[model samples]
Target: ANTAVKVSIDPAQDGPVINRHIFGQFAEHLGRGVYEGVWVGPDSTIPNTRGIRKDVVGALKALKVPNVRWPGGCFADEYHWRDGIGKPEDRRSRINASWAGRPEPNSFGTHEFFDFIQQIGADAFISANVGSGTVQEAADWLEYLTAQDSSLAKERAANGHPKPYEVAFWGIGNEVWGCGGPFTAEEYVTKLKQFSNFSTNHNKNMPTQQVAVGPDGDGFPEYAEVVMNAWSKRTWAWNIEALSLHRYTRNGWPPNIPATGFNQKQYASVIKETLGMNDFIKTNIAIMDKYDPEKKVGILVDEWGTWYAPTKGTDPGYLEQENSQRDAIIAALNFNIFARHADRVRGANIAQMINVLQAMILTDKEKMVLTPTYHAFRMYVPFQNAVRLKTNYDQGVYKEGDINLPKIDVISARDNQGRIWVAVTNIDPKQSIDVDLSLLGKSIASADGEILKAPTIDAVNSFAKPDVVSPKNLSLKAINGQLKFTIAPQSVSVISVKSQ
Candidate 1:
């Protein structure tokens, strides 16, 4: 038997205020994502700009990757900011490179990263090393970025740019519960408080926006709650601006370990994790409301995306997984979650921006290609400064025997330009869903859509021949007082309607 679902989007009603920060990117000192991806070293001959890749910079800007987080994931914990500065030849060398145990040269440290973000025109969110790093270290790092005039500011000018990056966002520590030290809530909070105390406007008296590592939901419920609770009690020391959570998608599918070659089962597993995000946000936000009813602290899902095992023989530290049609599905779904919960979920960064988990762009030596996830972000970029329209999903469901998952087939946005755009994703890999839009406030003029459907989930594009799987404009029809369309299964569809 087949079931029907209807998603009634009320474009007139204001849903959630979409924060541009919600659509952010992450850059870790891992794999080819940084070393070979963004920064190929100013000295390299691959066509770069001050150790940063000009092509990568152009691509990220075009995609409007609002904010880019730097330093590390777990690597941030061990990162020594001081070593990254000074002369590149004089920079320190270390083995805490990444999960792959590669050599982490601080060649592309603070100044290099800030320049990259600035050139790309995206806000820089720096995640400082707090594990092996000290409070003085964290504080000084903040000053180095924002402080205007000091021996520290002079050092920055000496390094390169005199005008400070003035970065407002700073993450205390990464996964302190896991690779980051597994510190008790009390301990982490104390450490966080201690770090925040000096790190405040100290270096050059730069204003800072502090983000403390919350208890991550690595199966721990109070992970974020504990961090929030501790922050609530602290004195004028900790200026907690955001609480972060990190979650990665894991699918038990072969050859799909490094995120390549995903079957139906693997796709479903990954889909389940992505779909579960709706509830995850609600639950996590409720916990935040426990200690913070006013929702003062911005809920930051700093690291999120599908994470299978690493690709065989590839750079393991790079976290470079194959992004396919299925991965694009995950991106659209997760983005919908962020849009739906834009209130508490102020900002979110996919695992690792380039060549990382569900990343948008993949680079190889002198060549690079855009991923499906990248397209999805670019497609949904129209919703950036727009107000989300309330969507009432149809009473329809897609189920497989005992498994029935609700379809988020309809998400609408009203841009500042007064254009009404609705993005829909069909989870059914085979059955296309019929959507009827009646409550969208008299949109009887004309309609056009874009469809991103591929032959299989694992399909990808290469630099040798890109554009293997891209979203193409779709035709639409308007009838009666309602607009009607068919969304392809396992595909992402976006439709825009014209009406006064």
Candidate 2:
């Protein structure tokens, strides 16, 4: 048996609130992410609520998704909101130049997006076009969505809904350093100021916070420096509340990593690569702190998750990739990292919610299967809006070739109702780790939750076999004032404790 890892949690210490937005979801027009993966026509045989898939909505509702960033990653830059606002048949058809030159019918537009989120009880985070759109266009779009009684609001009313939609957050652009635009940091900042100045949330009661595009990832620190530096010097009229960052985990791009059917070496490599998220968050937050010392301007990791080679015979532009146990580990590691920095790492949205990279759900016609990443998200739902508890643990090393990862990753938090929760990830693929947990200032009366694990690192849930990677019940007993439990190898376990 391996030596036991010690975990100590101080529930009395004040820590940052794990913002519910950190558990946000992303839906883009790329591939079937917004199409068949989410919106199947109301007339289709699939179970749906007004064109939105009922099963997808039902699944996401269980996770209590706080927000959904929509319209695009790169697609947002080229999208013209006007093209999607009117009658369905009158809506214009355009080619998605950023993604495989596929025909975009504009079927699932602004109205449809809000309807889907409403059904699932999520706030809207709309990404406005900046790469190929003008300031006037963006301002008008905002008015159309939030204005109480403007001409655009009337137009919106004529289209369908009589009430203005509540947009909680607005993203100015996507990856301006790359697909959003090849613009240099300086140029993008200039555009950001202009768009931010005109983009007004007409409904004063439901003010929308504006987010400017920041660096793509650690590869380009200059983007953050330039954007944050510009923000620091900005006047009251042109300020942004947050900056957006986009990063994905993969060995390298051209995405050679296969989503499934991989060796243990590849699994370790992926785990090691994903562990870099903590460093990425720290490095970017450091840059932000240099400019905004008070940390008022939050950092939203709007795009993150594992990206792999497209499934064989699938459209490469669609970014279709299978999800597995390795992806689940990646998700849990990222969640823990975000929680540790909850003060400034305000929110995050996984790359693509469905039928895309690191998706939570995958669909084939009418059949839907939850991915292992989905299970991870479901298990950690208790951490949403929960105050972080200072947790210290000794994580031993798991070595594979030159790759070294902490065998165990753990985080603890106290929810609003005073229930303490601990999320543990056993990164080792070959051995379970026994945890000797000590609640420093609390006595556990009961502990129970769920555990997600698979027999193999590459294990996945196919349409025919949906329960292969599903979560199972986990119960822990406190013996002599210490909570003891063994975490399965390559598994994620979330335990909720009620203390006396």
Candidate 3:
């Protein structure tokens, strides 16, 4: 029997406004993620603007990408900004030790990154190198990007960009407990104070919020406890406005899970694992609330997404994985979770932007194809800055062996333009679920949006067949203030409702 779920949304009981930055992306200097996936140089045959791919910028703009974190996951710790600045031919070269020891040509540097984000109409979230760098180095880098009349600013002008760039968020360091520094929570807090103190914003109009490294999911609550405790006692001289947390959905490290050709058991395991993100957020937030009762600090899940073993023949260090419908569902689930905790959950960036992990766009030289995860991000654009409406639903169970999941997941919000948007995901892989929505304080006249559903759970889009998994138009009419719709199994749908 098909499951019947009832979702009650009260627009009158408006909650926190979901931050648009929650839809941010991360672009690292790893694998083809930056080299071929996003940059191909002006001399290449691919259509590019100042060495940045045009197709990628166009596709990301459609999603209204709020921000992009650059200079990487582990790469930031080893990257020397000075090496990536000057003339391309004169630039220094180093081995990407974090990745597959590939030659780091320093081709795509700071100027190129700002240009790419400008083209996509997104803000910049840069991660500083504290593991292998000094406070002076991090401070100088900021002056170079945000300083107006300083020598670094003149240096920036000598390169190309005469004006200072606006950096929205500055991550102190990434994964300080691991690849970043392997520093103890106490040791890292000391470094955080020194780095945050000197990393000043020269562009007073655009102040950059500092993000301190936090825990690695629920496993290390001590990291959050210590970081927040330190933040709680921080003086006006040195403080952080946000804390960073990193989490990824995967079977295990040295990933044994494959991105394709998985069976029902594997699929169920992945869904069950991905759903744990809710608990991860709740656990960490609880700790934050204890130390900072006023909620002055926000949590940024900077590195997240599905992590499967690299596709066959791909470099293991590259961390490249194929994205499927399963990935799309995971993306929707995380978005819904983020919306529920919008007050403290200010932003999040999927593991990588292109051709890495669960990416939005995959590029092969000149050809590019949008992934299912890309469609999911496009569909959820309506919820970017919308105010969250109080939603209640009786979530039934969908069981596969020992793995149990909620049959249906949902989130509804009222956009700035007064349109009510509802996102629903049917988690069951075999049976479709029926949703009956009752909206309070709003009489729905009609509803329409896009639905992303593929023939199978593992369905994906390839260069040869890009449309294999894409969103299709969906329409529904409300009767007596109640909207009815049937959501296909293992699919995500976003509906825009207009009041009568």
Candidate 4:
């Protein structure tokens, strides 16, 4: 038997409130992500509310999704808001130059998105088109959504609803270093400031939280420095409240990595990349701390998650891929990384929330299936809104090829009900590890939990086998003030213990 890994958690010591927004999701206008997977058209045979799938809505609500970003990633920078408004029939059709070059029908636009968000009880975080749009266009879109009274408000009312949509978060652009625009950080900062100035809060009751397009994962420090430096020198505060960052966990850049049926080497490589996010957050936050010592602006990892080659015959533009138990461990590690840094990591939306890369749910016509990543999210819900608790653990190492990773990853939290929750992932592909639990603040009176695993690491769920990888009840017992349990290899486990 391998030595038991030890874990210690302190409930009395509190840190940042793991903001609900940090558990946010992203739904871009890519492939079936918005069209069939989310909006199935009102007249379709599927049961839907305003063209949004009822099953999809129910699943997202169960996850307690706090927010959903809309419109685009690279697509957002090129999207023209006007084309998606007024009438669905009258709305213009355009080529999605960013993804798969598919013709965008503009059927599910701003109104439809809000309808979906409302049904799911999530907030909207809209990304503006800065690469191919004007400041006036950006400002007018906000006016149309948030203005209580005005000609644009009248135009919005003419479309359908008379009330303005309450929008709190707005992204100035996406990936200013690449698809967003070709401007240097200096030039982009000028544009970001200009765009923020006009994105006014017509609804005084709901103030807007403006987010500037930040650097990509590789472009940090240098890109972040230039923008933060500009903001520091300004005589007044920039409207920007958050700086965005995008990263993807993959074996290589793009189009080479496999989505499923990978060997242990490939899996380890991906795990190595996912684990690197911890350093990414630290270094980026270090730069943000340099300029804004008080952390006035947040670090929004708006685009993140596993990205792999498209499924064999599917359009590469659609970014559709099969998710496996491997992806569940990936999701678990990344979410824990975000929670560990909850203080500055204000919000994150995993890339393409449905029927796309690393999606939570996949839908074919009227049929919907929850992926392992979805179950991982469901299991980790207790981490949301709870205060972070410092956890110290002796981590075992898993090695493959040239990569070596900590065999275990974890995050701990204490909810308002005084229940202590610990989420743990054992990433070792071959061996289950015994864990010795130490609860710091109080003794564990009782413990119960669920574990998500499968017979094989590559095990995945489909419409024919939806329950192939769902969570199962985990057994645990508190022995002499210490709770003990065995974690399966490549599995995600969440344990909630009530302490007196």
Model 1, 146-198: lDDT tens digits are 77788888888998878877675788888877667678777787788788778
lDDT of 3: 0.91
All candidates: CA RMSD (Å): 2.5, 1.0, 1.0, 1.4
CA lDDT, every model vs. true structure? 0.78, 0.90, 0.91, 0.87
Full candidate order by lDDT, most accurate first: 3, 2, 4, 1
C-alpha RMSD (angstroms) for model 1: 2.5
Q: Per-residue lDDT for 206-309 in model 3, tens only? A: 88999999888535668999999998888987989899988899776688787989888899899888988889999999999999888899999988899998
lDDT of candidate 2 over 354-439, digit per residue (tens): 99999999999989999999999988888999999988998899989988889999999999898889999999999998888888
Model 2 weakest lDDT span, ten residues long: 214-223
What is the lDDT for 331 in model 2?
97
Candidate 4's C-alpha lDDT?
0.87
The sequence of per-residue lDDT tens digits that candidate 4 reaches over residues 1-500 is: 65479899987789898887888899998988998999889898999987889999999998999889888798998899888887778999999999888899998888898889999998889999888899999999999998889999999999897988988689998887788787788888889888888788687776778988777766645778887787777656456788888888865566577777889998888888888888988888998899999988898899999888888888887999999999999888888888888889999999879999989999988899999999999998888899989889978778887888899987899887877899989999788889888887677778899999888888989999999999999999888778889988889999998775
Stretch of 10 with least lDDT, candidate 4: 230-239
Q: What residue runs in model 2 are displaced by over 4 Å at the alpha carbon?
A: none
lDDT for 233 (candidate 2): 94
TM-scores of the models, in the given order? 0.93, 0.98, 0.98, 0.97
